[model samples]
Target chain A: MTTMPETVVPDTGPADVPPVPSGGVRWALVDGWTLTRRAVAHWVRDPAPVVFSLVFGVLIVLMFGYLFGGAMRVPDGGEYREFLMPGMFTMTMLFGVGHTAQAVTADLDRGVIDRFRAMPMSSAAVLIGRAVADLLLSAVSLAVMVGVGLLVGWAATGSAGEFAAAIGLILLLRFALSWVGVYLGLVLTGPSAVFGAQTLEFPVAFLSSALVATGTMPAWLGVIADWNPLSSTATATRDLFGNPGVGGEAWVTQNAVLMAVVWPVALLLVFFPLSVHAFRGLRG
Target chain B: MGASGDAVVVAGLRKRYGGKNGGGLDGVDLVVPHGTVCGLLGPNGAGKTTTVRILATLLRFDSGRALVAGFDVAERPDQVRARIGLVGQNPAVDEVLSGRRNLVLFGRLHHLGAAAARARAGDLLDRFGLSDAADKPVKHYSGGMRRRLDLAASMILSPAVLFLDEPTVGLDPRGRAEVWQAVRELVGRGTTVLLTTQHLDEADQLATRIALLDTGKVVAEGAPGELKARLGGDRVEFVVRDRSRVADAARAVARLGTAEPTADPDDRRVGVPVAAGATALVEAVRLLDAAGVAVDDLALRRPTLDEVFLHLTGRPADRVEVRK
Candidate 1:
């Protein structure tokens, strides 16, 4: 290539940047909060998806509580609606993975993720903010579901402490699964992947003990269901909620609370790093 | 922050992919002095976007040294990112968020306080002529408006260097012109711009210097006029009525210009660079008439970027394979 004579450099001074420490934990928190606000603002501007997801959750409850409740029985012969409530809460949390993935995929498709990656803000803040925002939405959805549950003749018979603990377990499951969503959003390709994820989540949600007793499943399937992370949370939340679908003979089911705590933590340990790696490796 | 006067310095950059997909850069070297636009002009898959992506600290290059805003792209991407801004092919702003909201969000991410961010957002909206639509969601804004918002988002920190990768690829003619006007304004404010485009006119209109890329390499680098000049003055092109007479026409026209004439049998056209524009046209016409070769079209035209691409890369610009 032919070279040209060097042109004169202009006399423009440095960019007008204020002196703000842009490193370490404080900036990370600031950046994370900023991105969280961005995600929340999107929810505010386009409330359809959020509204649809919440309505869909409620529809599931109504469909099962009234329409399907007569045909099903809890293993310990408790009210089917009571047994179903804790399961529904756990399912609501689990479905958050789909929401998280959809949001992430939308950002990626729109090249918003690329812009965020190119910025000087905290690298982890993108995923952190997304996870936190999704958690907030999940918390809202859980509260609405709890209200619907109570209206449908279900009660949290446990003490206030156990009730809080059940909520914590539910949110923890959501917090953990959100990383899976982040990783999937980063790695999956095409528009179909987002919708495809929604379809795939059905089996993951249904095969667990969220709506029925794992003991009712085939013996081989019951073992698998009993060990499912969703099942652990469902059983553990039922135990905490003092709802009566917690009966299972498998060691994993008997140790639901420990497994409930262990599953999400394990998922976090596995997926947090994976999500970070995926975020850092993003390229087109 | 650079010790040298250049805002961007790329040395022998190389990035290779696993397969034969031709998006890999061989060894690209570039220098863009401060406060000037350096256009990376090429056809699709010419590695233009790859270079910009690396310099913007968004991609990790396999090998090479790149310094943007005085920070090494590989070793200190954060520093480079802090000083540089990027407008990718897509608008990248949230479709659901209002234009003002998008800008303020970017401002806060840039570490501006709430009041300062709002003030800056207002200023940018005014500067970009987006104030009327500032409170409207970006999805409702026109293509030009969305691009303007994208530009405003990138300018939140008044970055020293801006990397625009095919910034006007999908816009209509009017939208393209709007973005070009916006870019000119930014350039006047002393932001060094590295713009990549497949549009020759876009490069011609905006870049003070253009680096012609082909097959992931800098095939030619100079000002637009200089690149055109490198093709050797004006050319008189003519089409023959009879395809068989194209050779005869070239044989006649060859004597009119000092250099040999090139003929296309398919188009029955012959073109040759000449020392004198109008005189060469008249002489060529007379010679072709004398040779009994009927002419279809004749004109003296400056070398186009398409010709420049052909002259430098031995192929038309658009024929290059798409890069991954």
Candidate 2:
């Protein structure tokens, strides 16, 4: 037989095929779904952390409802559980931000993020996918805490539509805060920095109206609480549940709702790009 | 790109870390042919991995023009990434997920639909001999098994070109062999591979062509045999019967050959370089006998790749000492 050619032909099979009709947004959604499902599956395998996180929420609710409920009366025939539920919901969303930082740090340490950076997927997909995943985990955590509250005699007097709207509002706030976690995770160098950032979560949560009504706090402190994003979510959830409104002005009512929506949107605007920039700067 | 085309081309690739004296790659140039395995041979700090990272689109080059599969890495990184797969020194699989799940995750990331992703994961598990542990958490995998899984993960996208940076660095001999077998199978399927390693033997075995990197430059490059042949001589080594006659034997052997004879004082051996065939061997023996120098043992050998590396780098291949 004749000698073979010096160079054989390469196999350029279907990778060179036509591009898919999917746009960047569709790709992001699919990637986000995949990432969220994977995160949930990981939680299924290790449920201890989920339980541990819920216990913290339960403790906060029980301590405030029993120890302080006798001294602080709920107007309009509302029970302490109703007042405590909204705060717990806000606390859950805020605490879930720490999980985002933890997950991103894990991905960074394991070099999974680097692997994604080298892939053909959209650059923004990595961070958005992670945020979406964290949001889903936050939803599950919120559901469990709410279910436990109901079992402990908490009830919502509002219509089902209002409750659904409250849930949507809580998710929007969590989704925004998730970007803060994503941004912090990308900017921090190691796990120790992540833990340090996590320490700030508890103080931020407690400083808001999560544990006590803003009206009972010092005048100056109450002003700060009214402007806090957690306060907005907590107040909105309390209003939807037909619980007694903590004394605040008309500005506080509109500002809380605006802050709740604007905080995540603003965070997405700033931290979203920051996360992408950090991802790009990883090797540097 | 065609097999006859250039699979990867780099010109003036430069990168520097942000500390004093922390440059990684400096003014590097390289080209890899399609459908061929190019071994990037270097010691720990020789910038081999840096070069591979730039080509694979995992790290950016401060200033350079790098084209992988005909796409500029800097200008069109996603396109470059689409055509190449990188199996870095560390495995990038999710430890919490099962081996099959990890594979399926990557498959989906490559845009393969659910059913196709599952089917591909099953096939890869079998191919990598991970079928038994397919459903087990990769956190429980041994180093070698994890490496196999990492290599298998890169193939899910069916990339046209593959980059392996020290793929067998921490593997046992058997694991290395298994990886070699898997690599050969990939080559048989027409995947172009660029593998970097500090192991000389690995380069000799796996590379169709090798580039020896020193400091920040490629000092020598060619096929192993061509590099060896360039050293120019069949090596002749023999032990002299008497230590005192070593001087005389050296002189006699030098006289019989065009090259100089070297004497090892501690081992009582004299080695001389000669051309092919027994003529020079017989002449050296006769000259030694005339000088009353007895030979205890004699043998002629061809130059090894180690000798080629030593001759080119002006230092022993295994004992390369990098100055900080």
Candidate 3:
């Protein structure tokens, strides 16, 4: 294309920006905190989705607690609501993993990740910030589930210490699952990933002992259900919360709490670096 | 920092995507002096976006050097990023967040203190005429408002150099004009800008210097006026009313120009480049009348960028097929 040549346009804005001061840990933390707050602000400004997810999780709990409660019989003759609470709590934490995928993918598709990468801030801050925010939300969501469990006549007969330990295990799983979210977000970009995660949710949750007793199932299916990673946390929570349904000769049942901690730790070891590597690869 | 005064300098930049994809740079070279708007003009697959991506440190090059704001893009990318701002082809701001919140979020990510980020966000919102809509979520914003908010987000640090890649790719005429005015204000503020666009008129209106890229190469580079002037004097175009007399009319139109007249069988028209302007027009009309060639329309027009693109690249500018 051709046109007239104007005189050289002058620079009038500020020039010679001072070099960005470099500090490793402090800057990363600060950047991460800022991004976390940004995510929180997003939730606050548009709470519809957040509220919907919370209500939806509770709705599932209520449906299973009341509607399906009469049909499900625990092997130990305990209230189905009591047995279902631990299973549902574990499922809720695993379900939070899907949110991580959705959030990460949304950021990637919207190019927010690109903007963050272009900045000179800490590279891990964006992913870490997202995980931290989601973890905090998971805690709130778990509290709501626990509250719903109490209203439905579900109680932990264990001590306060055991209850605290059970909550900790559930949240640790949530934390690990969030990194899975981060990895999936980067791997499967765009709006479709949200629906994909939603579609995979029920199958993943049901394939374990979250809502049904492994002892009531066929031998092969029961063994598989007992060994599912989510079963570690569900069995551990049942034990820690003084609920029913924990009978197996395998070491996984004998050491439910230990597996609960180990499972998420193993997942974190795998997904944390993988997610960071994916984040780093975006610059390419 | 670059060894030269140019805010941006690139040499022998090369990249390849391998296989049938086939869209990357090949031995590209460019220079934009400090504080001037250099229009990177090209078609869809001209590698204009790739060049900007390399300079912005968004994509790594296989070979060669790119310097932005005096810092080498590959070696000192962080420094380059601190000094440069990029507005990509699509609007990247968050739709769920308010316009003000989006700018503030970017400011915070850049490591500005909370108060400082807020102040800058407010300042930018006002500067870009977004104060009226600052409190509303970006989803409520128009195409133009979103583009302006994107500009505001990129300006969070008042970057020394700003790279706008097709800033107005899908806006209406009024929106385009609004963005053009905003760009003028940005240049007036002394921020050096590099604008890449497919719209020739956009480049014509904004760029002080034009770099014509085609198929991953800098095919031509100069001031827009210089490029047009280099094409030589005006051209005489006329269509014959009677299709059968086109050859007779071409002979008539040929005698009055500096070179042989070219005829288009489809339009039944003929065009000739001539050194003489009005005299050539009168001479062509007289010659055509004497030959009894019925004429429908005739005129002498200056060379537009459309003709220049055709003259240099041998095709229209918009007919490029972008490859993934």
Candidate 4:
């Protein structure tokens, strides 16, 4: 007892060490799905934020639809409420990028991401699950904005199929924006950085035909607005919804539907892989 | 334990941050016998967390072989992660979720079905004394409860080896004891633990073997009592009332130890660093009496691990105060 008094126990330890199979593609897919479910589970526990994001978009829509709709002149005697629906939907999707960024950074700072890293799950599951969950949340937020638009007499006069396509465009924009969120979250690792990243959303959305017609702006500014991806989606969504939108002679407005699909797809092609690559280098 | 039962083994482990001479491990080696707790004792920045990180497969070491549960950490990280659980220096469980959900989330990640994950979550909640707070958000729990939940989250699968880096750091005494109790329960169930701590008392209380690390290297490795014995049993110290008599007492006690006794002028004390139990205690009084150095008070104090660290490294283990 005088020397080395601590009791040392002997054990038969677990030998359930999984083999490092060169490829576990199916396992990775299953694991990625499970992690996506986990990300969805967060919504169940904290639905307020989910609800608040929806309501925040609704509040913005209401503000623009009524508070400013009467004073603001709609192009060609078109209802301002009708002109604002597509822009609000695009703005709602853009705002979701900030939410995703903040959530990702919070997980990183709190070691939640570290927990997943230490596990034997697929590496891509972390970002993929988060992106999927954020996409779903953005869809809900867009739906809330649409409900607000309908209440204010903003009619989608197009066919049911056109409405579905418009929704698909909004969600596609959300998916691309979420990749930007994931990249910024892994790289910045600070709440303030999320706010800084979100600051870009306003300039990008406002410079376009989102809130107003690009024709109302100067020629140079209007040209830049027409070139914006948000403008493409907003103009395309308005055309598809049969809402009042700028009928420009320019190629971008004329081909709004194609550019709407092309822009978000291009963004996904660039940022989705970029964010995945960024996640791989996060340890550095 | 048999050689095959060593749950964790590191050989020639080296890592550097930035370029060179940045805070990281440098050619460190360690071994933990199965089912026994190995306390990696060191001050802050002593590479404890770094070593644990490498073993847990969350880090890439510059050059080394780290084996966990008999799987090479680098070549077979998936194999290693499948068997090992890491309770990091910070709690990693989600605060927004209830303790129960947190456990189930980990269980599901480990590939347990929903029914099995729910059952395991229940069992862990009971084992960790978190059943009462299982349904409450973790943000509502106390620090101790959160740590217990963190431990529970890691043990969802009864991992073969668990790495807890400074688990009790920043915990209150009650909280620390609760965590220690939980750790003890895990160890009793045949889980090997690699615990990094700065508290000497904590190592004494929980570790089967203690590896004292300094500047990313194991300075000493042994049982607590064995390390204490290295300083030669007990410390014999006395203070003289008269300042003038301090020098005479120091010279008298200098002959007692293998090395010269150290004198503290501020306390008017001279202490013999090494003494073989009570026999030297008796001899020290006789010698001081013979040297005409009257002592105000004299006693033989058992040397603590802190003293052993000071004796071995010529520096006190900074931040080594009994934290809990």
Candidate number with greatest DockQ: 3
User: How accurate locally is residue A284 in candidate 4, as Cα lDDT from 0 to 100?
Assistant: 51
**Residue pairs whose backbone atoms clash in candidate 1:** none
Stretches of model 2 off by over 4 angstroms after superposition: A1-23, A63-81, A215-221, B1-4, B230-234, B238-249, B256-258, B277-324
lDDT of 2 at B148: 79
User: In model 3, where do residues sit more than 4 Å from their true spots?
Assistant: A1-17, A21-23, A217-224, B1-3, B238-256, B263-270, B276-300, B322-324
* lDDT over C-alpha atoms for residue A202 of model 1: 78
On a 0 to 1 DockQ scale, where is model 3? 0.36
lDDT of 2 at B113: 83
Better of 3 and 4 by lDDT: 3
What TM-score would you give candidate 1 relative to the actual structure?
0.90
Ranked by lDDT, the better of candidates 2 and 4 is: 4
Residue B279 lDDT (model 4)? 80
Interface RMSD of each: 8.5, 7.7, 6.2, 7.1
Sorting all predicted structures by lDDT, with the top scorer first, yields: 1, 3, 4, 2
Q: B182-226 in candidate 4: lDDT tens per residue? A: 888788888899999888899989999999887778889998988
Q: Given candidate 3, what's the lDDT at residue B2?
A: 43
DockQ of each: 0.35, 0.28, 0.36, 0.36
Give the Cα error of residue A135 in candidate 4, in Å: 2.1
DockQ of 1: 0.35
Pairs that collide, model 3: A3-B225, A11-B190, A12-B189, A12-B190, B1-B70, B2-B70
